[model samples]
Target: MSETNSAMTLGKRSLMGLVLGLAAGGALYFVPECWLRDDFLINTVFKIVGNGYLNLLKMTIAPFVFASLVMGISSATDVRQVGRIGIKILAIYFVTTTIATTFGILGGLILKPGAGLSLGTFELSGQYEAVESSFADVMLGFIPTNIVASFAEGDMIHIVIFAVFVGVAMSLLGTQAEAVKRFNEDFANVMLKIVNMVISTTPFGVFALMATTVANLGFGIIYTLAKYCVCEIFLFFLFGFCVCGGIFTLLARENFFRFLTQFIRKVAMIPFSTSSSNATIPYSIQFCRSIGVSNKVASFTIPLGATVNMDGTAIMQGMTAVFVAQLYGIDMTWVQILTIVIAATMGSIGSPGMPGVVMATLVVVLSSVGFPLEVIGLIVSIDKFPDMFKTVLNVMGDSVCTTIVAKSEGEFDREVFYGRKAAQ
Candidate 1:
């Protein structure tokens, strides 16, 4: 075969190998105990590859997030535009998050998925170290004491703030700073190239992540919380598809389902598998750009959305709170429900860009409103399942918010929004 054809064949083989590996790992998870003990080689291969993939993804996260944020900020035109976009983005983020949490709470109340469950003392193995930052403290945290330290710690908010300041300074210097701006742009491209290199191995990582999860914690965990899981999934689809779609349709004067189908065809799988809003940032940014949202709007809104606009997390918080309350037979007053909405909304802003951060924030919010802390453990076992769905909604929310903001700011292309086939 010619070199090009040989390379293409090898690429297809590699892709198939990754898929087969994942399937084999998943199958091993359901193998009989006797078979598992006899199949030592099979178990060894599955464990090593699956665990190795997760570590690789984790390794890339800190650098990818910091670099992506820095690149985004450095590309902005001015601090004033950044500030304006920040404010608008945050406003929409908080409002929609509050609305999402409310829907979750409302759904929980009506569904009562956890109703009549007996209270049990459950232990939480996952420990979250509290970063003591009030609203003012969080604001102060944005000003990095050391850029390297911020990047090392993966403090996204701080990185974003520092990048904005540097970007502003670059813009101010104009002719003098052109070289620096160009260098930064090149650096950003290099980092993105690294991200692409890492993402190319995603199928391997995903297979391992899924295999380990299934093998260790079987589908039994989900079966146990079957009702609660069903209710949360129902609410997620309702709010994400029905409610958010309706708003987009009304605003854009187009069929919401059609728009969703177009967008989802591009982004649906990434968030579903990764279960992270931050990880999906690049995809969300590209999706916005493809739909004709300007670079300025896409960069500003997508990063900010990843940081604070957590519709899926909000929904989980509301529903999980009520689910726990029902499981523990705790009576929640009207005032308590209102408090949940407020706390969940605020918590989304403070929550770290980690997979289970919302679960930690949920404990804080629920405890603040007089719910038992042990109840959090009950939800933890089933957290990953709902989290996957929540992440999809989170990305969807960011895209919708970006589209709306771009439209209002006159940064959106009408033709692109209408799904015309053409280059961006």
Candidate 2:
């Protein structure tokens, strides 16, 4: 009863935060930047509090993920199980990312959001130049050059590599790994407690984030990006409910509507304000636990998902590529379309963990088929809205993958998942 009440309370608080964000954005949208004054309310008050909340969330992310991953890997019977789990998660991630990109391409080609618009609509600045990175660099970079540096720099992919090595070694050690695994579990719990505490301050953070965004972007930016935003949202829901919810649940033998509403919706809506999967990791893990995912699986999959799973980002790449192509009146060749699918799938795998990492790598996706890079600047002013929704999609995809893997492993508690039995 106590745990149920706590979750309920948290859900209400989260909803209230979202509402406050909407209210703030709507109210502030009417105010001119000159009248609003960025230094006073936007910076000193809103930015400070909002960024403080985000910082607290970031504070836990790397450590919590490290601890969780170590503990999860150590719990596995051997390296084979751990290897299998990693491969499965990555496979799911690849399939979903490819699907997302394909849909994104279709959305762009069909909707033609950028078609018939005058080039004069967007002032193209040839200002930003991307220092290109090869596919080889991305792949070779995954192996940790220095394990300590990976953790210190918060290089998640490398950290994952380093952590897995340590975990495998510990697992092979048997009795020796027991104490270390327990310690990692304890550390993860402490971080989770901190995450809950940080989440308690979300209402204020949401209010700040929304207000600042609207005040800064204003109505002009919204109108310009409205078409793109709509397409992204539609694709996000289509993928979330239909792909992740409908098809996945059917395969897992879980109720689609009931499954989404029962827990996923409660937690999945969070990234609208937070906008960072790193911050949302703990809450996602909490949701997994509530739905009866084993801690071992949740710990491994959630963090790994946050780092590697970029379905939403892949969608952004595909759609935005076509959107840009349309702006320039360039018809994409079939080979280029295939190139986007392949590059985005691989790029999402190697993408960085930082906020706005997608936009950075968007260049790679675009360059594969010779999509204009300068158009990136035009979209920058309006990327926030898409980024928020995409992050939600990214997080949801991760959760879905986690749940599916858990069910397959017999690590899921069905009664608890459906809310028929309370989570322990």
Candidate 3:
């Protein structure tokens, strides 16, 4: 009862913050330039508060994820079972991403968002440079030569790899490593407690972040790219509802709408406001636990999903390819479409989960099919809107994936998941 009440109160507060921020920020955008100066309000006040809150979330990620992974794997019944869970999770991620990308491409084809517009109508600045890394590089970068540096740098891929190594070793050591396993479990709990502390301030943080975004972008940009934005946002929901929710329904044998309500009631606003999958990890795990996913599965899957799962990013990249092709009057062949899918899928894996970084991933996808890089400039202006929605999709994907896998592994508590009993 207490847990439910706390979640309810937090949800109400966070939703209120989101609404108030949008209202305040949108109204502020219409203020006279002399009264509402960017230097004083948007850049100074909003930037500081928003980034400070974001930093608080980032501060917990490296240590929290590391400890969770260590504890989750160390406490597993068997090493082979850990490997099996990993394989299942990866398989689901791959399928979902591919589906998301396909849906994005099909949406672009059907909607033709850029068909009527000429390339000269919009400003083309090839200002974004994609730091292209190959699949080989991404794979090689996973192993950390120095674990301390990985944590210091907040390199999630390396952190995940090192933690897995330690976990496997502890699992193999049996009774000799029991004390270390307990320490990891206790440490994860401590990190989660800190995360809870940070989460309580979400409403305030969300308000500042939203206010800053609206003050800068204003309403016009969203209107300017209305078609493109609409298409992207539609795909986000389509994928989230049809793909993620469908998987949950098919596997969990529960009502997806019910699940959706519960999900939104828990952590929807954080991802939407922050535009970050990394920042939402702790909350995703917490939500999973609330629905009866085991700590072991929740800890392992949620963190890994944050690192590798990029369904939303994949969707964005795929749509961008078609949108750019249409804008440039370039006819895309089957070969180019295939290239987009392949590149987008591989690019999303190990990609950074921070806001706006997906633009970098989009560069790789566009470049793969020889799309003009300048088209990215137009997308950049309206990227935040889609970024907000896509982050929500990505985070939801993480929770759904965690829950489904938990069910399959018999790690799910049906009573709690179905509301027959409250989470203890």
Q: For this target, which candidate reaches the highest lDDT against the unseen true structure?
A: 3
- Model 3 lDDT-worst window of ten: 121-130
Q: Model 3 off-target regions past 4 Å?
A: 1-81, 120-224
Q: Which candidate is the best by TM-score?
A: 3
What are the candidates' C-alpha RMSDs? Answer: 9.9, 9.8, 9.9
* Per-residue alpha-carbon lDDT of candidate 3 for residues 303-386, written as tens digits (9 for 90 to 100): 878866878888888888888877667766665676677667756765556654465456557645546654453464456667
Candidate 1 per-residue C-alpha lDDT over 109-174 given as tens digits, one digit per residue, 9 for 90 to 100: 999887755454333222112334356653453367998976765443444456557655776676
Colliding pairs, model 2: none
Q: What is the TM-score of each candidate against the true structure?
A: 0.59, 0.59, 0.60
Model 3 lDDT at residue 314: 86
What is residue 177's positional error in candidate 3, in angstroms? 23
Candidate 2 weakest ten by summed lDDT: 122-131
Candidate 1 lDDT (Cα, 0 to 1) = 0.64
